[model samples]
Target: MAVLQVLTTSVAVALLWVVVESIRRLFFHPISHIPGPRLAALTWWYEFYYDVVLPGKYIFKIQELHLEYGPILRITPDEIHINDVGFLDTVYTGLRDKYEYPLRALRVPGGVGATADAKLHKLRREALVPFFSKRNVLSLQHLVTEKVNQLSEIVASHAKEESQINLSDLFFAFSNEVRGEISGIMKVQSSGTDGKSDRNPTEKEAVYESVLLNESLPPQERTLTRLEQEGALLALAGTESPSLSLSIIFYHLLANPSILDRLRTQLETVPVDASWTQLEKLPYLMAVIEEGNRLSFGVTARIGRRAYEELIFTPSSYANTPGTGTPNTEKSYKIPARTPLSISTLSAHTAESVFPDPFTFDPERWLGESGRERKRFQMAFTKGSRKCLGIELSNAELCLVIAALVRSFEMTLYETDARDVSFEHDYQIAMPKMGSQGVRATVKFRV
Candidate 1:
C-alpha cells in the first residue's frame, strides 16, 4: 500500500511539471508574442506532426498558417518562417554570417552541404569550385550529349514495345550516368599504341583525384576520408534534384498538348548537333525550362539559418500594410542573435502576386520583359553564397536531355493520374503523392 502511494505521487508530480512548463512556453517564451498555433508555441511536436507524420504536408500547412496568422509566424518553438518575397534576397544573400539549423538527422557530418561553420564551408566550397564552373560544364558538354542520346535510344526501344516508361527512373539513370562520366568514373582510353598497356591513363580517374590534385587544398583537407565523403556528397547532390526536375518537366509537357506542340516548333529550328549554349539562347525553350523549375518545387523544405549576429527582416507591402498602414511600403523587424529563420522556396515560387495564376503550368508566363523581371523571384536554384554548387551542370543536363527527348520522341501519359505528377510530400526534396507510379508515359519515336 505504501509503494502504490509513492508511485501515484510521482505520476502527479510529472503531470504538474508538464502543465507548468506548457504555461511558461505559451505565455513567457521569447517568441510567444509572435502568433502561431498554441500547440506549436508549447512544443515542437506540432511541427513534427506535419513534417513527420503527414510527410511533406507541412509545406502546405505553412501556407495555411500564413493565411491565419499573417506573413511571419513561429513555425516551431524556436524558429520563425517568413512567407514574403521581398525578404528572400536579404535572408539568403548579403555579408552576414549564417549557420544552418543544427538538425543532425538531416546533415551528413563533415560533408560539404553539412558544413555549418562559415569559414569551413568556404574552404570546402573553394576546393570544388573549379570542377563545377560554367567553363568546366561547357567543356563537359559531350558527356551530357552522350547520355542524352543513350536515354533517347532507350525511350525509342520502349516506344517500339508500346511499354510505359517511368520517367522518374529514366531521368535518375541518365543523371547518374552523366555524373559518372563527368567525374571520370567511367573508363576512358589514353593516348597509347597498345590500348591495354599499363602505361595508359584514364580520364582524370575519379572526381576525388581531380579535386584533390589542385595544389590549393590545405594539407589537412586532403585526407582520403574527406575525398570519399565529398565524392558521395557530390554524387547525391548532382543527381537527385535535377532528375526530379526533368521528370516534372516531361510530365507537364505531356499533360499540355498545345504547349508540347509549341516546344516542338521551337526545337525544329535547332540543328541536330546544336550545342547547349545555342539551345539555351532559344527564348521559348528557356521559358519552358524556367516554368519547369518554377513548378518543380526543388528542395521544398524550409532552409533554416541562425544568425551569428543581429539580423533585421523587412516585410513587403503585402505583409506589412494590410489595412493598418500605407500601401506598398516596408516594415523592419529586428531579430536577436542566434534566432532561427528561413524563407521557403516552395512558398516563394508559388506566390500569386509574383507569378499570376501560380498553379497553372504556363511557359508563357516566363516570356517578355515582365517575365524576365519576375525571374528574379525564382529561387529554384536558391540564391546567395550557399546556392547549389551544381547549378551549371544541372542546367546543362536539363537542357541537353530535355531537348533530346522532345526532339526524338512524342510522349503522352500512360495509365497515369494527375496526382502522380503533383508535389504531394516534402522529404527535404519534393516528392509526388504517395502510391504514385512515378510519371509513367508512352512514347512514339519521331520520324
Candidate 2:
C-alpha cells in the first residue's frame, strides 16, 4: 500500500509539471506575443501532426495559419514562419545559421548543404566553390550534349516502337545517370552506390580532391564517412530537383499545345543543333524555364535560417492573402535574435499579390520588362551565402535537354494528367499524388 501511494504521488507530480510547463509555453514564452494557434505554441506535437502524421502538410498548413494570425506566425514551439516575400532578403541575408532541426533530418550533417553553422558552412562551401563556377560548369556542355543524345535516343526508340513512355521516370533516370556523372561530380554522387571500395587510389583521390586536399578542413572533417555524407547530399541535389523540374516542364509543354507551338517556333529561330548559349538566348525558352522553376519549387521544404540579431518585420501586401479574408493591418513586430524563421518557396511562388492565378502554367508572366523585375522574387533556389551551388549547371541541363527533346519528338500524354506532375505532397522535393506513375506519353519522331 505504501509503495502504491508513492507511485501515485510521482505520477501526479509529473502531470502537474506538464500542465505548468504547457501554461508557461502558452503564455509566458519569449515569443508568446507572436500570434498563432495556441496549440502550436504549447507543443511540437502540433507540427508533428502535420509534418509526420499527415505527412508533409505542415508547410501548407502554416500558410493557412498565417492568414488567420497575420504575417509572422509561430509554426512550432520554437520556429517562426513569415508569409511575406518582401521579408525574404531580411530572413535569408548575411551570414545566418541554418536551423538544425531540418538539417539533422536530412542526415547529412557533414555536407556543406546540411551544415547548420554559417561560418562552418562557408568554410566547407568555399573550398569547393571554384569547381562549381559558371566557367567550369559551362565547360561540361560536352558531357551534357552526350547525355542529351543518349536521352533523345531512348525516347526515339520508344517513338519507333509506338510505346508509351513515362517521361517523369525517364527524366528522373536521365537526371540521375546523365547529370550525376558530370565533372568529378561522379566521384561524389556514385561513391557508395555499389557498396564497394575497390576504386583505384587515383580514382578515390580524384573523387574528393577538393574537400579531401583542402588545407583548411580539419582532419576530422575529411573522413571517408563524412565525405560519403557529402556524396549523398550531392547525389540527392543532382538527381531530385532536375528530374522534378524536367517532368513539370515537359508536362506543361505537352498539356499546352499553343505554348508548345510558340516554343517550337522560337526553337526554329535557331538550328536544331543550336548551342546552349543560342538556345538560352531565345526569350520564350527562358520564360518557359522560369515558369518551370517557379512550379518545381526546387526543395519545397521550409529549411529556415536562424537570425544573428533581432529583426523588425512589418507585414507587406503579400501577407494576409485575399482567401484569408482578414482585415488589412500592417504592423511591425520585433523578432528576437537566434529565432528560426523562413519564407518557404511555396509561399513565395504562389503569393497571389506577386503571381496572379499563381497555379496556372503561364509563361507570359516571365516576359517583357515586368518579367526581368519579377526575377527577384524567384526563390526556388534560396538566396544568400548558402544558396544552391548547382544553379548554373542545372540551368544548362534544363535548356539543353528541353530543347533537344522538344525539337526531336512529339510526345502526347498517355494515361497521365496534371496530378502526375503536380505538387501534391512535399517530400522535401515536390511530389505528386499517391500512386502517380508519372507523366506518361505516346511519342512520335517529329518530321
Candidate 3:
C-alpha cells in the first residue's frame, strides 16, 4: 500500500507541472515571438491595468508600446496591436469585414448598434443610411442653421454681459440640440435664461441635457400617449450611437488659434448667404474638419469582426503584406469562421508612414488638390461599404456651423493647459472628462 501511494503521488506532481508549464508556454511562448512587455507574456493584466485603471493613458501606453515594439505587439492571448498604416488600411479598410466591435451593449441597448454578423451590419447600415442621405441632411439645413443661430445667440448674450462662459459646455448643448433635431428623437435645450421672452420657442427656451441621456415621464395625458413617450425616451437613451466625434472637432478648433484664423479666412471667402448647398465648394473648410477627425478619433478602444464564414484578408489593393509597406493581392491572415479581430485606431492614425508629422495638426494636407491626392488614405468617416451613413450630413452640418462660426466669432483660447485635455476612453467610446476646460475660448462677434 505504501509503495502504491508513493508512485501515485509522483505521477500527480508530474501532471500538475506539465499543466502549469503548458499555460505559461501557451501565453508567453507563442506571443513571445511577438514584441511587448514580458509581463504581457504572463497575463493580460498588463494591458488591463494601463488601459482601465489609469486615467486618460490608454493611447499613450499603446503609443509607447508600438514605439518600442514596432507596429505589431501582443496585448493579450486574443489581441494583437497593429500600428502600421498599411496594417490599419489592410485590416480596418481592406479587410473591414473581418473585424467586429465586441462592446456594443453598453451604448446602444437592444442590440441596435450591435452587429456581429457582416450581413446584419449591412442590413443595419442600409436601414440607417437613408435617414442620413445627402438629400435628407441637406433638406434639413434650415433646421440646422436655426439651431446654430440659437446656440450662437445664447453664447453671444453671455459675451455681451462680459460674463465668463463655459464654451465647452455650450458645445455639448449645441451638439445635443443638432443631434436631437436631426435624429428626430429628443429635444435638448441648455441655455437657462428664464422670466423673459426674447426669441421664438426654438430660440429662447431651455431643454434639459437629460433628454439625450435619460428618459422622461410625460404628465398624465392618455394611457397610449404616456406609454408611447416612455418607449420612445427609452429607445433614445438605449441607442448606442457615439457622439464624441462632435466634441472632438470642437475641442480641436478651440485649441489651435492659427487653424481658427485660417478657417475664418476661408469662411470669409464663402458668400454671406451661403447654405449647406455651398458646402462642397469650400474644400479647405472640409479639410479642417477632416484633419480634426484625424487628430481626434472617437473610436479607438476595440474593433473586431464576427465571421459569418471562414474569411481571409486578401491583398488586392486593400491589404498590406507583412514586412512590405506595399499592399499585396494575396490573403495574409486566415481568420476562422466566427472569429473576432480587434483593432486600435489611435495607433493607426498616428502611424508616421501614412501621414507625415502624424502628431501635428495640419489641415493643409487634406485641402484643395493636395487633399484630393490623399483621398484614398482618408478614414475619418471610416472606409469600405459599411462606412458611416451620416458622412454627408455630418459634413454639411460641420461646414455650415464652422463656416458660420468663423464668420461670427473671433475666438481666443482662455486656458493654455486646455490643449492637453486628453481622452477618457474605454472599449468603444471616448470623451473629455466632465468640466474639462479644453475649449475655453471667448467668442467675440466679428463685425
Candidate 4:
C-alpha cells in the first residue's frame, strides 16, 4: 500500500510540472507575445502535425498564419517564421553575420547540404565554385546540348508512334546523364556515332585534378567517400529540381494554348541547335523559365538560420506590418541571439501583393522592366552566401533542354489535367500529387 501511494504521488507531480511548463511557454516565454496558436507556442507537436503528419502543407499553413496574425509569427516554441518579402535580403544576405541553424531532423552528417557550420560550408563550397562557375558551365554547353539533342530524338521517336511520354521520367533521365558526365561517374566517349566530340572532365576528375591533388590538406578530405558524398548531393539535386520544373512547365504550357502559341512564335526565329547563350537572349523564353521556377516551389522546406548576434528587423511595407494600417518605418523588433528564424520560399513566391494573381502560371507577369524588378523577390534559388552552388549549371541545363524540346517538337498533355502537376506533398523537395504519372504528353515533330 505504501509503494502504491508513492507511485501515485510521482505521477501527480509529473502532471503538475507539465502543466506549469505549458503555462510558462504559452504566457511567459520570450516569444510569448508573438502571435500564433497557443498549441504551437506550447509544444513542437503543432509544427510536426503539418510537416510530418500532413507532409508539405506546413508551408501553406504558415502563410495562412501570417494572413491571420501578421508578417511574423511564432511557428514553434523556439523558432520564428517571417512572411515578409522585403526582409529576404536581411535574412539571406552575406552583409550580416549569420549561421545556418544546426540541422536536426535533416542532418546528413558530413554531406555538404547538411553542413551547418558556416566556416566548413565556405571551405567546402570554395573547392566546388570553380567547377560550377559561369565560364565553366558555358564551356560545357555542348555537353548539355548533346543531352538535349538526344532527348529531342527520343521524343521525336515517340511522336512518330503517337505514344504518350512521361516527361518527368525523360527529364529526370536527361538530368541524371548530364550530372553523371559532369561528376565523372559516367564517362562519355569523345566521339559518338553522330561524329560529335563531347569531352569534359567529370566533377570527380576535376576535384582530383584541383583540390585532391594538393597533398597539404588533411587525409580525411581526400577520401573517396567524401568525394562520393559530394557527387551524390550534386546528382540528387541535379535530377530532382530540373525534372520538377520541366514537368510543371510542360503542364502549364500544354494546358494553355495561347501561351504555347506565343512561345512557339518566339522560338521560330532560332535554330533547333541554338546555343545556351542564344536561347537565353530570347526574352519570352527567359520569362517562361523564371515563371516555371517561381511556380515549382523549388525547395518547399523551411530553411532555418541561427542568430549569433541580436538583429533588428524593420518593416518596409504595409503587408509586413501588423494590422491594416500603413507600415511604420521606425517600428522594429530585435531577434535575440540563439533564436532560430526561417522564411518560406513558397510564402514569398505566392505573396499576393508581390506576385499579384500568385496562383496563375502566367509567364506574362515576368516579361518587361516591371517584371524584371519584381523578380528581385524570387527566392527559388534562394539568396546570399549559402545560395545553391549549381545555379549557373542548372540554368544552363534548363535553357538548353527547354529550348531544344520546344523548338523541335509540339507537346500536348495526354489525358492529364492540372491535378497531376499540382504540388501534392512536401517531401523535403516538393512532390506532385500521389499516383501522378508526372505530366504525360503526346509529342509531334515541328517542321
Q: For each candidate, what TM-score against the reference?
A: 0.87, 0.91, 0.70, 0.87
State which candidate, 2 or 3, has the greater TM-score. Answer: 2
TM-score-best of 3 and 4: 4
Q: Which whole-number lDDT from 0 to 100 does residue 129 have in model 3?
A: 49
Clashing residue pairs, candidate 1?
Answer: 56-426
Candidate 2 structure quality by residue, lDDT tens digits, 1-447? 999999999999999999999888888877778889989998889988898998888888987787678778998888899888888889887989999988777888888899999998988888777767777666667778998899999999999987899888888787774233333544644474432355433222233556766778898887767877877788788788888888898999999999999999999989888988888899999999999999999889897899889999888666646555343557788888998988899998998777878889999999999899788889877898888888887888999999999998998999988888778777788888989898889999988
Model 1 per-residue lDDT tens digits across residues 262-310 = 9889888989778999899888888988888888766677777666668
The per-candidate count of clashes, in order, stands at 1, 0, 9, 2
lDDT of 4 at 37: 81
lDDT of each: 0.75, 0.83, 0.54, 0.74
Which segments of model 2 are wrong by more than 4 Å? 1-6, 177-207, 323-327
| Candidate 4: residue 339 lDDT (0-100) | 70
Descending-lDDT candidate ranking: 2, 1, 4, 3
Candidate achieving the largest TM-score: 2
Give the per-residue lDDT digits (tens) of candidate 4, residues 301-371.
87777756677766667254333345534456778766777787777887666787777898888888879
Q: Clashing pairs in model 4? A: 56-426, 182-203
**Comparing 1 and 2 by lDDT, which wins?**
2
Across 299-371, the per-residue lDDT of candidate 3 in tens digits comes to: 5555654435554443244233333445434324454555444446665565444566765667788866767
Candidate 1's C-alpha lDDT?
A: 0.75
Of 1 and 2, which scores higher on TM-score?
2
Instruction: Itemize residue pairs with steric clashes in candidate 3.
Output: 99-304, 99-305, 100-304, 100-305, 107-240, 108-240, 189-207, 315-328, 315-329
